[model samples]
Target: MTGSSSADQTVSDAPTAPGGRGLSPSALATGGLVALVGYASSVAVVIQGLAAVGADTAQITSGLVAVGFSMGLSAIWLAWTQRKPISVAWTTPGMALLAATGPVAGGFPAAVGAFLTVGALIMVAGLWRPLGRWIAAIPKPLANGMLAGLLLKLCLAPFMAIGQAPGLGLLVLATWAIVGRFARLYAVPAAVAVALAAMAMNPPVSGALPADPWPTLSLVAPAFTWEALVGLALPLFVVTMASQNIPGLAVLATFGYTPRVPPAFLATGFASALTAPLGAPTVNLAAITAAMCAGPDADPRPERRWQAAVTGGVGYIVLTALAAVTATLVTRSPPILIEAVAGLALIGAFGGSLLAAVQAEEERIPALVTLLVTASGLSFFGVGSAFWGLLFGGAMHVLHRWRPAGA
Candidate 1:
């Protein structure tokens, strides 16, 4: 938490071994698990979201590559530089928003422009102290509640998938439970492996993959318009900030690690801006998966845990080469099964967030309101519910604090 350059220097100087003299086997394993869970689980949503915005297959493939590279680079740089396990990820809520909004007035190009705007917003928030501080000032309970809300539906996907594919789904859940009892860190990754195996055995009915396994960048010229900007950009920015960045910081805080905030924001913002033309969405600090790398499981010494994030980044970069192929395979799999595996992976994180949300008695009402509003999926004037949840919860908190006792 203390902003001391000497402390960072000391950690960076610490001995380690694996890939050179600064890597550990545990870190590498945790990193691989983080990358696997982050990408394999929700990549379908990204593909669908891009398609919903009228992006072609090539564009979708390119988006995946760009996003993978961006997050990988960001995670590597941030973790290594700060000497902290600061994993980065694309905003899931932003993808969901894009998927739900469908094509804007100007279509995919407009969505690209909107993404650029969101990137600029993130960069500005990083540069402008007030904005960053304002976002940071959001109450911890409310932030946790918003995250819990965002994760709740996805966390329940296992049961839903069991209804759709009972045998396989139950198998996946059973694997997760059994593995969790003995080796909690490896549980989700093992479940993901099982899910992938099931998908391989019962492959979906897609026609074929491209002969060229590589995904090429397809530049989409920006088409800015009020419709797209307001309808997409603003909401995207808010969700990325509140549901992703804020909660991400909270996740780090929970582990007693606080890297420099603006640098993290700026790195993702720059990455977003650079990749927007390739139809990539915004990359930000990871909220859910951060716990995996930051916790004691990654490394007994918290100071050395950053190696895990760097390893995850390396994993992302390696996976980027298979972006097109992976996207094709994932899209072909049964959507419910992928979601179920994702839900199983996130159950721990969801529970942690929910517990944090209601820890304090006085904060319970506001926290619950935030969770309900965010999960309600309410949108007004094109603003997503994450923003509204924070606004309403903040207002409620203010009133409660200002009111007389017992009133």
Candidate 2:
């Protein structure tokens, strides 16, 4: 009877280990810091994008607040279930492309429309299991190449900023890399330390800040247009699924685990669909950022990486509470500081994605085309570079497929 009882226990459940003692709290802290900086950098960029497109500050912030709230909540949920480190970040490339086309295109209504369309499509992706698999079927080389090209512009900001602000930027970059490499636990502290130190030491510290340090949430309305769907929604959806969502799954696979992709995709898709009415962009899997929270450095056991992500979600909540604080603090920081920190944080991730993008035996040319077109920062037919990259790359692949071996 004792032996039979022991057998049932083993079959029903794997032995549970200590839950809280494993991860480097500091690494989680650093990742949260990275998310904070990355979020700030993207916020400044979004403000610029919205302005270029003729959006009022209030409208832009409302839209942004919508996005902010959804992202924070989604990250928390993902962290909870996966019990693996996971986080959701705003679309840097998506916003950049929007900024580029915003002024000349259909305008803010169009942008909101695009966001909604993308959200709906993502919902479709969730229900259509085969479609998700098809997206997964994209050759890794093509995907990785697309990623590198997509990220090319964003990644360069940090080093360029470092060159401009030698005293502060350099210190932050140096400290992040050194501590991130060695102690690991001190990585985030190093970045925060440098940022605080710079703020204290820099002479031009007289920037006036907003009165409210906490955001007051108000309901926002949505206006949709067909043009926006073609221009923003379709392109954003393609990139989110291909570059972000695809690589996100790869991160889990790299760690020798497989998740129920359909549910994950469906849940985020539903999340996006719901939030779109509120003016936030589509929600999808996080690639590079998720990796930071999930990888070996996050937890020695690897199995316990989820704790780091949960920590991040909690931190995100705190930050969200003081979003009014977010705007002020983010505004006070120099653009270069934001850029440099983002660049350094993404170094490892970008490298990995680039490698995965070009490893195919037959599709090298198409892969290169994808990289070049994406890196060129070109948008066409209301579509962003990721779409163009895939279009051109896919065409090239098809063309190559039809070509005779010796013709």
Candidate 3:
């Protein structure tokens, strides 16, 4: 009976090991720091996207609440269950896409419906083998190129921000450079801390901050239309998949943790679906921040690194309570400061994607084409640049493959 009991204990403990042991100080610090950096870098873009879609203050607050809860909860669950450093995030490119797309014909309600559709599509992409295979089958270079193109504009923001707010921007850059010299992982978050301090030192005069930072939940009933389906939903679905989810998976793979794609897709999709009426856009696998949690800095043991992600998840949940405060502070601050921080945060990702896009000789031309089209921000007949970039690049690749050698 003692042996049997021992055997049962071993079986139960085996799975939880992936989530790691001790929840060490290093893991906790890494997780919380990465979470802080992730939120500080991209929350501004999300606010802008929601505002562009006509969300009021209360609605935006609700959106933040929903997004925070979804990402936090999902990341916790995925990391704990799989014992892998799987971090989930709102699609930054998808937010950019929405901001650029502006208002839909049917307004914010229509946009909410489109958000629901995107969630449904993401769920299908996860659950449907054919769709998952199709996504996986996409050429790596083209995917990288599309990501590069999509990010080019935002990545350029630091320079522009410098032009707009020279002192603050320069200080932010200088801090990032200095901190990165010793502790590369903490560099951006440190820069973010400095930038916030600088903002406080020189507060903006607009001073429209709310008295209370507690966010109120607001529901916007979804109204789906054919135009929204074609214009917003389809394009959002495409970019979120091509630029966010696929590359996110690739990032994890590089760290030797290849999670099953469908579960992630389903988790994020359901989260997005449930939060749509509250004004949240789609949530997907995190690309840049995942690298932070999955890297060696998070843990010496690859197996134990899941603790970092779980910690990051816990940090995110703690941050949800501060959403209203963050939103208020960010909205009232000078826009250039936020832009500079975001651009700086994404510089590494942009460089990595660009390298991936051009690494192969055969894929060079197609990848270049994809990057150019995506950066150009060209749209046609309601489709966004990312979809067009992939479409054109894929065609170019196929044509190149068909051509005879020495032709």
- Which has the greatest TM-score? 1
- TM-score of model number 1: 0.82
Off by over 4 Å in 3: 1-30, 52-54, 92-111, 139-160, 204-209, 219-235, 250-257, 291-308, 342-359, 370-390, 405-407
| lDDT tens digits by residue: candidate 1, 69-158 | 999999999988887889999988789888998989999999999998898889888886665466557787887787677667778889
- Lowest summed lDDT over 10 consecutive residues: which window, candidate 3? 1-10
lDDT of 3 at 181: 88
Q: Who wins the lDDT comparison? A: 1
- Report lDDT (CA) for all predictions: 0.78, 0.61, 0.75
lDDT of 2 by residue, 230-342 (tens): 66677677667755666566444434334556666666776666765554556566655665665555555555666666666566556666554565566666777866665
If scored against the real structure, what TM-score would every candidate get?
A: 0.82, 0.74, 0.77
Clash pairs, candidate 3, are: none
Report the poorest 10 consecutive residues by lDDT, candidate 2: 1-10
**Best of the two (2, 3) by TM-score:** 3
Q: What's each prediction's clash count?
A: 0, 5, 0
RMSD vs true structure, all candidates: 5.2, 7.6, 7.7
CA deviation > 4 Å runs, candidate 1: 1-24, 104-107, 207-211, 223-231, 381-385, 405-407
Model 3 lDDT at residue 39: 75
